[model samples]
Target: MFVLWDADGNEIRDEYPPVDPLDILRNPENAAFNLDTIIGRLKELGGSDIVALHQLAQNHYIVLDASTKDGRHYIVRIARNSVTSSTSARISNIRSYVRIALDFFRINAPDGIGSISSFKSTANARSGEPILGPYILPSGLHTPSNVFESIEEYFRWLISVKKTSTTVGTTKPDLDEAQVTLKKLENLISESVSGYRYDAELLRGVPSHQDFSGHNVFINGEGLITSVIDWEFHMVKPAVLAADYPAWIRYNGTADPRFVDKTSQFSSYWMAGPLDAKRLRQEYDAVVKKEDPEYHRALKAGTFCRMAEEWLLSDVVDIGCRRMKAWLENSLE
Candidate 1:
């Protein structure tokens, strides 16, 4: 079973036979919409009164709770975070951030660039300050900075974060294929251009929480978002870049039929938005071609192979790790 805990050491929630939502639902208890129980628990947790738990667009869900004094139902969301143990989980996480950054660049910055809001960027962790980025939760909490303010600060910060180890056009083999692809696509990025740039400034305007997968977002019965809670893995990218952030799951083994089946079970609203699909692809192509005109030209003649080479490495890694794990298990047996 998978369990979630609050800072107080109390169990916040638990799932038996822990699996993704799409994995097991036949068990009535798991399928049961024990709203009453959940609501009761929330009230005990300083929540008002419980109204309803409804599904929202995408895989997100909402919880409606009313304050006893005013009887106004407050919204709360419950989202799932999908990260099973795997060798490249860290790489996958980083790639997910990149995917979100690109996605946000496409949507929110259609005309140019869009940045997510920023917060104090630090927390009270004894290990030092925890990086607390900005995000809007269903709880209706507000950040001190507005979007404009956040975006400006992000631009200023980007000036210092330019990935200097390699130039935009140069290949970065130490990085993943996606990063390499991004590096090759730098010419398309410009200070005044309307797409992702290869410099540090290009990434400045990201809105907080780039990984807005349907699994992490929850909507309630009334269609109100209750909580957009998981900020631990948030990224700072353009707000629009996250428009198609959910698609990143496809790269992380989500394309497997098993994974798809599991996701569909929980989120019927999961589907690509047409406009976004078109724009994202267009933006991707524009960058790839602009950054490596020679490679793009070769691709036109059907000789381009680096792009495919870049994509295949991850699968090779995944297979190698899986085989190693299986072999180890068999040896132990």
Candidate 2:
């Protein structure tokens, strides 16, 4: 119901419900607009020869596969209006931050970090010149940065957002419980680590693809990671916060074992030559402990804090809140 593609493979995005521009301006998460304009901008940014439109998620986004005249395939992702609306410096700062983090990971863990394409925003492609219309990112990745100078700054922002954004539902007792649990955890973290700047020699500012899962990555014939996509939630966080295994391996007990096994295989293949999951976890743990003997305590606290933040910021509060509650109880031990 959100987007359609024509015989010419051009996009037609419907905003028939007519979302308020002010709402989009206030929170880019409410953004929705014409996909054709985005396509035009992509063309300006060196994409052409539109071939097919493959829907990635119904009513969410679509991927447009195109080739340059020189035969270079490009994946053009178009999101529904409910994704991002921020076209300001905040988004730019976030993009720069993620780029720096990814670059750092590439330098430090060239074998472990998977291959991924760098984003080419319209502005960046035009040599940092200003562009009209909403900020158009390559592959439609939504990157928004609220600018936190330190982990303490991030925590304050998280608390403020959670307090302002949480809503009570009549039928969702579990959600209510999650909110309460999250508040308690947040308080604990604030008391334990407030003003404690993370400065571990082995683990201070490591890159984390916060949403690193099978869905966001692509693998090749040889079982190596051909591409890692979806840098929307990328950040440079503390080793305790960033160094955990991918969520797929965490096995919340509700995940299908068959699917988990498949994903595990893919992950193993992706890092087979350079590393394995056991070695990766061991290396991360060793570094974390070297940085702080009480690293396990920090890891438990940081993991809970991050999950609570994700719950607060996510649009799907029911699922997010459930995850917060589950992880708070299960992983905090």
Please provide TM-scores, in order, for all candidate models, with all chains considered together. 0.27, 0.42
Task: State the displacement of the C-alpha of residue 7, model 2, in Å, after optimal TM-score superposition.
Answer: 28
Deviation from native of the Cα of residue 7 in model 1, angstroms:
30
Q: Tell me the TM-score of model 1.
A: 0.27
Q: What CA root-mean-square deviation does each model show from the true structure? A: 17.3, 16.4
Model 1 per-residue lDDT tens digits across residues 106-137: 43321122223332333564343223324332
How would you encode candidate 2's per-residue C-alpha lDDT over 8-58 as one tens digit per residue?
334443222322112122333432334456455546555464333332222
For candidate 1, the 10 contiguous residues with the lowest summed lDDT are 303-312
Over 4 Å off in model 1, which ranges? 1-206, 239-333
For candidate 2, the lDDT comes to 0.42
Candidate 2 lDDT score at position 289: 53
Q: Which candidate is the best by lDDT?
A: 2
